[model samples]
Target: MNAGLNDLQAMHLRRLLEGGLPLDARPYRRLAEQVGASEAQVLEQIQRWQDEGLFRRVGLVLKHRALGFRANAMLVLDIPDAQVDEVGRRLGQAAGVNLCYQRPRRLPQWPYNLFCMVHGREREQVCQLIAALLAANGLDEVPHQLLFSTRAFKQCGGRYAPPPAKEVANG
Candidate 1:
């Protein structure tokens, strides 16, 4: 819990945050209005929560399909454990690579441990970008596979607090 914030105040603020910060010039001020706090107070509380490790980051969740980025691919690489981190860093910084992360490889079936997401307006463009990235990163010899997205899925930011329960009408 943040200092000077009661449980109710914290819960209310959290619920508002779960919905995402308002799209206003002074978003914190808007939030302050909703939570009945000063703009500075709201900012301070958010900083305190971050310092306490309550959340890793507040970032944008892009809707690639809506943006006309029709071709999307998840490039999974079979990078050796010792080199995964260094290679992932290089690939992650390459142009056209939107996202990159490391995951554990499942033996026999799923051998790839590193993943990268690349998006573009066309399949050929995405593939060419991936090829250039591989060559630039010296990963041409690395075993990998590109899984192109076939269907769109709903995307949204994280939600921490469960929704408030609705009241039932009594007969």
Candidate 2:
């Protein structure tokens, strides 16, 4: 198993990743001070974390939907188990498909294993892209759903703060 983070490092990562990044020209300096580390040390540690798979991204979360994007849909695909990998890659490459991921299939009722997001200027445009994906992949008959957003409540990054471990008692 991969080694877990130590206390200080975990705390620093939690603050830096979950808590908002310092909004300054010398943000690293401010962040280091807050985390009780030197500026150079913070930068180095962030670079190291990037090298490791601890983080795929460390940046600002912009509000794309609020920025005049009229169409946004969460598309779930019920692809065959064997073809999931291939279809996921193709869906990821599809135009306007900003995000694509594989999820566990819930049998009978919930059959979708692939989920992706599509954003566009208009509903028609988004539908057209989805149609293109269906035709291009010869998956017109594949079970799927396009969940268009009626009201976007919250679109933000995941919370990176480490959850407090449960207390354990020994007999």
Q: Write the per-residue lDDT of candidate 2 for residues 65-166, one digit (tens) a residue.
A: 768787989989899999999999998998778999999987888999999998888999999999998899898999899999888788667876766566
The alpha-carbon deviation from the true structure for residue 95 of candidate 2, after best TM-score superposition, in angstroms, is: 2.0
lDDT (Cα, tens digit) per residue for candidate 1, span 4-59: 65666677889999888899999989988888877877888888899999988788
Please report how far candidate 2 places residue 74 from its true position, in Å.
1.1
Candidate 1 regions exceeding 4 Å error are 1-3, 53-55, 165-171
lDDT of each: 0.88, 0.81
Q: Choose the strongest candidate by TM-score.
A: 1
